[model samples]
Target chain A: MAAFIQLFVSGLATGAIYALVAVGFMLLWQTSQTINFAQGEFVMIPAFFVLWAIKILGVGFWPAVGIAVIASLLILGLLFKRAIVDPMLKHGVLPLVISTIALSIFLKEAVKDFYSSQAQPFQAMIPSEDLNLFGAVISSQSIFILLIASGAVLGLNKLLNGTRLGRAMQATAQNPSVARILGIPVERMIMYTFLINALLVALASLMISPIYLAKFTNGDTLGLAAFIAAIVGGFNQVRGAIVGGLILGVIENLAAAYISAQYRGAIPLILLIVVILWRPQGLMGRAEERTV
Target chain B: MMDFLTSRAFKGRVFVLLMVGLIVLPFFLRPFGLLLVAMWMVHAVAALGLNLTLGYAGQISMAQGAFVGIGAYCTGLMTLAGVPYPIAFLCSGALCFAIGWILGYPALRVQHHYLAFVTLAFSTLVFLVMRNEEWLTNGIYGLTDIPRPILFGWNTGKAQDFYFFTLLMTSMLAFCVWWIIRSPWGRAFIALRENPVRALSLGVDTRRYTLMAFAMGSSIGGFAGALYAPLVQFFEPNSFSLTLSLKLLLMVIVGGSGTFFGPFIGAATEVLLPEWLRIAQGYYLIIYAMLVMVLMMFCPTGIIGLGERIISHLRQKKISSERSAQAQAMGQDKVAQTKSDTQGGAGQ
Candidate 1:
């Protein structure tokens, strides 16, 4: 029972990170119909930036994180819009999809070539300390990860649901032409979503790096996991992503414990297939009305 | 000129020239070069399969490499177990066809990126199984020394002999693809691609055709993999990763997605260009990735599409210019007639 609880808690912690990444994915899909295949790389690149700042530039941890976030906002968020997204927007989804896949390869190989191919240990925000609750032990780092991830999600929820910018972004997502006719800057709103996505992925990167390790290939697994989580939870709903991520985390951990550890990675993929087959709209998403 | 360019004669001549090149080129190259060409043929076959699915039917798949892996393992294991090479090859293709038919179920439920993700998941799953199921796949140590086949007393253990065998197989496969593309099923696939809903309204069985597109495409991929096993003689699970899938995709896109000759050109560019670019060492892939991104951004139709565009443009220009020149001559004749009439009126 204790072991189960331990696995569940750790699962939730990782699930939180997956949720953050999924929400970012969902935002881009919702707004621009742009599925960023490089999303895992988005999470990956920022952690390296933070690592660069602290190790190479001799900055403090908080300041290093700040540098990483700012860099992501500028380069990944803004420059990404200008260079990759804006030109490809007119072409349709497939071109963008291909470009993002190319971007992912570029990012991965760039890191491997320019940065170290070896996995780098990242400094966790909180030092490790074991705490017991209900006969289950959890680390302070896991607890920190959970708190920060949820807090970020809540903050994003407030931004989207409460703010005018959020409503405008939502309006743009529903119908870009209609939103533009109503005087909302549709393109700008899309850019904002990209910015928001960059920020979310950056947070996820920082949170996950310590546990997952900062490596070039880290994006491959994390990216797929986030995709599965988002699809399983519900591709259309933010809340669904959260629930899906938590469920996936727990399920994967449990499977690793109870089932064969070697095939643990296969669990989410199998889950993705099942969910896609059974509930195409996802658990939290509504069935889209098809129009001719 | 435009008519000749698009004529049957021009295409037939091009085909003969290519055939001659294939038949004669290996005589000049060393064993390694022969092997490279054979590898290209294998990849070209796979890319052709992808082109049918993504280009003709407009169903995107990122699992072609996985199908290839399945084909390789199936053929390798079967032949190792004393099964005839021909039966193992057929079995591998059959296996992929059934698996691909099942994979098409997810496609029926989702479209575009969702479908891409489903296939991506599948590819990853297959990779995991291939890597982890050590008892069967040898768990990364990989099955080795798989013997080459003997065809009617023709020993294909030699690289040059194998190249000829692959060339013959590729030409046959290409002919099959050509026939399929010209058939009613091909028309149905094109319809399915242009608009599934409209195709359904037009009495085309979109579901069955969709499944057929996937099955045929995957079976072709399996055939390519079966060939790949004999050509390489040794390969690990890593050879069939998402990277291979993407590389095959690059070939289809770069060569021209919908065009018949696109896969061949794309495969050549993919296989040979990298070899040439080995001068850049580690930077070759980075260069390759950038080139693909640029290609997608500027010329999504690929190299074949670009050529088609230029040809059509010139044809239109020729037609328009001819029309204008004839108009100019007619206008002059009309003016002279009017002048003569006015002169006759004055004389009267």
Candidate 2:
């Protein structure tokens, strides 16, 4: 029971990171209808930025993280929008999808070539101390991750639901032409979505780097996890992504412990197939009517 | 001129020329070159199948490599177990057809990126299974020394002999694809691609056609894999990874999706270009990735599409110039008619 609790808690922490990435994924899909195949790389790249700042530039941890976040927002968010997404989007979703896949390869290869291919140990923001809860020991890092991830999600929720900018973003998502007609800057709103997504992924990178390590290949698994989590929870809903991420995290940990550890990666994939086959609108998403 | 360029006679002549090239080229090349060209043919078969699926039917699949892997493993294991290579090859194709048909169920439910994810998940799962199932797949150790096929006392164990065999097989497969594309089913697939809803309204049975596209495409991929097993003689699960699938996709896109000759050109570019780019050493893949990104950004329709665009643009220019010349001639005729009318009226 204690072991189960431990697994559950750790899974929640991991799921929280997946949830953060999934939210960003959902935002991109909502506003621009882009399934960014390079999203895992987005999470993977920021850790290197943080690493570069601290190791190469001799910056402090918090300040390095700040530098990483701002840089990610500009390069990954703004540049990605202006360069890849804006140009390829008009060609339709398939081209955009191909472009993103190409972007993923580019990112992966660039990192392996330019940065160290070897996994680098990342510094944890929180001190490494065990906290006892209900006869299960939990790391302070996991606790910190959970707190920060939830806070970020709540803050994002408040931004989307409460602010005028958020409403404008939502309007653009619903119908870009109508939103533009109503005097909202549709392109700018989409750009903001990209920025917000970059911010979320950078945060996710910081939270996950210590646990998973900062590695070039980290994005392959992390990106797939986010996709599975988002789909399982509900592709369309932010809340669904959160629930899905938590469920996936807990399930993956349990499967690793109780089931065959070698085939643990297969578990989520099987879950994905089942969910796609049985409930494609997702557990939380609504069935959308074909617009045309 | 355009009619001649697109005519059956011209295509037939091109086909004969290509066949002659295939038959005679190996004589001048070394054994390694023979093997590379043979590998290109094998990948061309896979890319051709993917073209049918993604290009013709507009279904997105990231699991083409997985299907190819399934074909390879099935043929390798069966041939190892004393089954005839021909029988094993057919069985492998059959297996992929059934599996791909079942895989198409998810496609019926979702479209675009959702479908891509479903296939991506499938490919990953297949990879995990192939990597983890030590008892069946031999895990990371991989099955080895799979014997090449013998056809009517013709042993294709030699590089030159295998190249001829692969060439013959590729030509047959290409013929089959050509026939399919010219058939009513091909028309139905185009309809499905252009607009599924409209196709359904027109009673095209979009569901069955969708399933057929998946089955046929996957079986062709399986056939390619079967050929690949004998050609390479040794391959690990990593050979059939997502990278292979992406490469197949790259071939289909670069060559020109939906065009009959696109896969061949695409496969050549994929297999040979990297070899040519090996001068860049470690930076070859980075260069390749950037090239693909630029290609997708500027010419998503691919190399074939770009050629077609250039041809059409030139044709349009020619037509416009001819039209202007005709208009000038007509203007002169109009002036002559007016002068005659005025002269006749003055005389009256």
Candidate 3:
């Protein structure tokens, strides 16, 4: 009983991190119709930045997190404005696909060049404290990561429902042309969507770095998992990302425990494939009307 | 001479000349390395498979690596089972084609990125299967000591012999592609890629075609992997990872996605260039990326496309000059006619 509960909690914590970044992915994808394949790199690059900030700039953890998030958003602004947003505006779908892939490669390789290519433990935000809840061991970092992930999701929901900018973003995603005609700056909304994605990805980095050591190849695995979360959650749905992440997390954990640890990585991925095929709309995602 | 120059026969002559030139060009370089040549052939086959879906059917796929693995593993198993080389190759390709067909149906319903993601997941699934199925793939140890393919009692275990064999296989596939492109069905495939909705309006079943494209592409991927297995004689999970898939995509894009010789030259450049710069292994991939970007920027049409453009431009210029010279000659004739008319009038 204790083992199951512990595994479940760990899974949820990891899933929560994926969901957080996946939320950002959903937002960017919904608005721009562009999925950043390098999103995991974005999640990973910030931890490296945080390390740099602490080691070189003499900043503490909290301030380093803030600096990493801000700097990451700024880079997102530049990358979106330059390589992505401007060039891909009216280009055909193929160019958009190809260019983003190119950008992904660029960012991933750039991270490797900038950081120490080997894996390393990141600076922890909290001390090593295990909390006993229902006979399961929960770490301070896991709880913290869960809280942040949940808080971000709720915050995003509120922003989408109540705020003017979020309303405009929703409007752009639904119908960009109509939004544009109604005097909404749809292009800015799209660019800001990227900004939000970067912010969320940075937050994910801050969350996961405590457990999963920051490494160059971390992007590939993290990116793959996040993509699965996005898929199982439904590509366009915000809430589905969280649900999808949890599902993926649980499946992966169970597989790791019950099956070979190496093969465990393949579990969530398989489940993701099955889900997408069975429910193209995803668990909580809106149903896309079939054109027949 | 003018008549001959204007005839279609001249075009055939040019094509033969080009083919002959290519055939004789390889002897010019030393190292003339066969292992690298075989690698290029494997990559070329992968790129061609990608082209079937991406270039022809207008679908984006990230499953090239998975399909290649399918082929490699299948080939490995068959060789282990004491199967003949030709039978193993055929079965490898067939297995991949079946998988492609199965996946194509569900995948066809999704749009661009979604489809790409599904294939990504599938590739991950493949890697897992390859790495985990200890009985089949021998787990992480990989299937080593696979025997070299024998042809006419001549062991192709020699590096140069494998190179020639791979090159021959690539040529056969290229010939197949040429035939497909010139066929009506090929036109239908391109039409579907260019505009699926419009193609559907013309009674073309886009789903069936897309499935066909996937199958064809997977078979090519399998063929490449089957050849790849015998060349290296060792198989590992990393050999067919997501990076390989991404590299194939880079090859397609950098080589100009929709062209024929693009894959040929692109594969050579992508494979051999890294081999040549082995000293810079530290920054080798970074250099490879920058090179791809440069290629994408300046030579978006690829080497073949650029060459085609240059050839067309020269032809156009030649035609324009001929037209001008003809006009000048006509003007001279008109002048002479006027003078002759005057003379006739005076005689009258």
Candidate 4:
């Protein structure tokens, strides 16, 4: 039972990061009508940015995090405009999808060549000591991650529900033509969605990198896991993504603990297949209608 | 422009040129180059299979690599078990066809992105199974010493001999694919791509056609893998990975999806360009990735589209020049007629 609690808590911590990434995907897909296949790269590259800030500039952790987030937002926003938004708007979805995949490859290769291909250690935000609670041991870092992740989600929910810009973004997402006709600045809103997505993924990377270590390939794994979370919860729903991430994280952790570890990597994919087959609308997603 | 490409004489010329190129290509290249060309042909076959699904039917899949892997292992194990090479190859293709057909069942339920993920998941699962299943796949140590074919007393042990044999097989499959795409079923696939609802209304049977496309495409992938296994003589489980699958898809897109010669051109570029760009050292893949992104951005049609664009642009220029020449002649005629009228009036 103690082992179970430890596993469950660790899963929640991991799930929090996945939830962040999943939310990024959900927001991007909703606003842009295209998913960023390079999202994993976004999760990965920011850690390297933070690493550079810390190692090269000799900055403190909070300062490095700030610099990394700012740089990533600007660079990714510009790249989103040039590499994705422009061409994607012109060519449509398939080409955009292909380009995103290319972007992913480019990001991976760039990090491998420019940054160290080897895994780099990152410092945890909190103390490295473990906390004992009711026969279960948890790290201070895990608690920190859970708290910050939840806070971010709550903040995001409030912003989306209460703000004018957030409502405009939602309007654009629902119907871009209508939003544009209503003078909602649909393009700018979409761009802001991209910016927010980049920031979210970078934040996720920063939060989890201490435990996972900053590796070029970490994004691919975590990004894929997050994607599964979004799909399982509901691609179009924010709360669904949050719930999905936690559920997936707990299930995957339990599976790794109880089942054979050799097949752990296959667990999410298997779940994805089952979910897709059984419920295409997803567990929490609405049944959408479209005219031909 | 489309008409010119589809014209009988033009197609015949293309056929003759390709045949000549194939016959002459082996002479100029070294053994290593020949080997690469053989490998290119194998990939080209797989790309053609991908074309059937993605290019024609408009269903995106990332499982071609896994299908190929299954084909390779099935043939490898069969040959190792003392079965003849030809029978083994056929059996591998048949198995993939069955598996692909089954995969189409799930495909019927999902939308586009969902389908992509399903295929991706299926491929990952296949990869995991192949890696973990020690008894059958040799568990990442991989199958080795797979026997090459001895077709009608000709030994295919040498690189050149194997190249010719593989080339023959690739050409046969290529021709079959070409034929299939021009058939009524191919038209249905195209209809399915353009508008599935309309296709269904017109009694195109989108589901059956999609299933057929999946089955045929997967079988071709398997065939390519079967050919690949013996030619290389060794393949680790990772050889048929997501990267390879993405590369195949890249070839199709880069070469010009939905076009007849796109897969061949794409396959050639993918196989050969890396070798030529080896001077870039460690930065080659980064450059390649950038190139793909730029290509998708500006030249979504790939290399084949680039050629078409040039040809079409030239044709338009020629047509405009001819139009201007005719206008010039008409203007000159008007001037002459007016002068003649004035002269006649003066004479009167």
The best candidate by DockQ is 4
lDDT, model 4, position A286 = 82
True contacts kept of 1: 0.71
lDDT of 4 at B291: 84
Candidate 2 segments whose C-alpha is farther than 4 A from its true place: A54-58, B1-10, B324-348
In Å, residue A72's CA in model 1 sits off its true spot by 0.7
Candidate 3 wrong stretches, greater than 4 Å? A58-63, A290-292, B1-32, B277-281, B291-348
Worst 10 residues of 4 chain B by lDDT: B1-10
CAPRI tier for the interface of model 3: acceptable
Best by TM-score: 4
Question: What tens digits encode model 2's per-residue C-alpha lDDT throughout B168-260?
Answer: 988888889889988999999999999999999999999999999998899999999899988898888898887788778878887888888
CA displacement after TM-score superposition, residue B150 of candidate 4 (Å): 1.0
Cα displacement (Å) at residue B53, model 4: 0.2
DockQ of 1: 0.73
- Candidate 1 deviant stretches above 4 angstroms: A54-58, B317-348
- How many collisions between residues are there in candidate 4? 0
Interface RMSD of each: 1.1, 1.3, 2.9, 1.1
Query: Candidate 1, residues A1-292: lDDT per residue as tens digits?
Result: 9988889899999999999999999989998888888999999999999988888999999999999999999989999888988888888998788888889989999999998999999988778899998989988888998999989989999988999998998899989999999999998999999999999999899889998889999998888878888889898888999989889999999999999798999988899888888987888888887665
Ranking by TM-score: 4, 1, 2, 3
